[model samples]
Target: MNRIIFAAAALAASAAIAYAQDPIVGNWKTELGDTAAIAACGSGYCITLKSGKHAGEQIGNFNGKDGSYEGKITDPDAKKTYDGSLTVSGNALKMKGCVLKVVCESQTWPRL
Candidate 1:
């Protein structure tokens, strides 16, 4: 009985650790009204469109933690990629992409 209890406890602890490692893993509603799914991919997170015209398209890749992340974002319409960063607050995620480290565009996405 003690061994069984220990195993259960270990499972629960690992689950919590996994969640804490990537609090941004979930679906979000983009400013343009599309659904974006962010999930762990390889060493970081991959953002893919789950709805709208761009469904199934991977638009972003980020690596970071504690509500802040940095990586690359793609403009689906333009077929261009830019330096990007993400900031999470409560149920909202602020995404920013920059061109030449000067011109930047930002959008806030709410968790779905």
Candidate 2:
């Protein structure tokens, strides 16, 4: 019984270690006034962007899951910045932009 218990404990510990080493612990690829924003977390994610000519003129909503977040994002093309709000789940992150507009979109991506 003691040997079985030790094996179980070892397996649990290994699983815990693997969870601790997750890579999607931060915000990623965010664009302002455009279509197609990118972000990954743990093993879950979400993405969005405005479509068409009004792309950069609209702000997208962050419907993030899991537990990730956005502290800040800069748009090189627009030469502007957006304060980020993020939600993360496993390997997914839902995002919302601080700027105001009418764009709501989400998608999951590989953890980066």
Candidate 3:
């Protein structure tokens, strides 16, 4: 009986972990053509560059849910940080960043 109870507990834990992962939690090719890994981080989501000049750098934090997020992102190419928003759907993520509500750039990233 104890072994069966433990098995059930373990299964439940594994299911919870799987459910915790958001749909956006995966590796993707960035707009700048770099590779990035996106996953849950510290009560939000984190974007990390895996390849390119900014390899292994955390680009920014995204706070949102249901395929939409707003946060800050670093543009490695330009070496700038700006307020950013991301929308993910069907293996594609649309990322937009604005500099002080003025200059804004958008890019579409596909899952890798």
Best candidate per TM-score, number? Answer: 1
Q: Per-residue lDDT tens digits of candidate 2, residues 1-112?
A: 9999999999999999867643434433333323454434334433334354444432332333436554544444475756666665665545554565455334344333
lDDT of each: 0.94, 0.48, 0.90
Error of 1 at 8 (Å): 4.5
User: Model 2: C-alpha RMSD to truth?
Assistant: 9.9
2 versus 3: better lDDT goes to: 3
Shift in Å, residue 39, candidate 2: 12
Instruction: List ranges where model 2 is wrong by over 4 Å.
Output: 1-18, 26-66, 100-112
Clashes in predicted model 3: 0
lDDT rank order: 1, 3, 2
Q: Which candidate tops lDDT?
A: 1
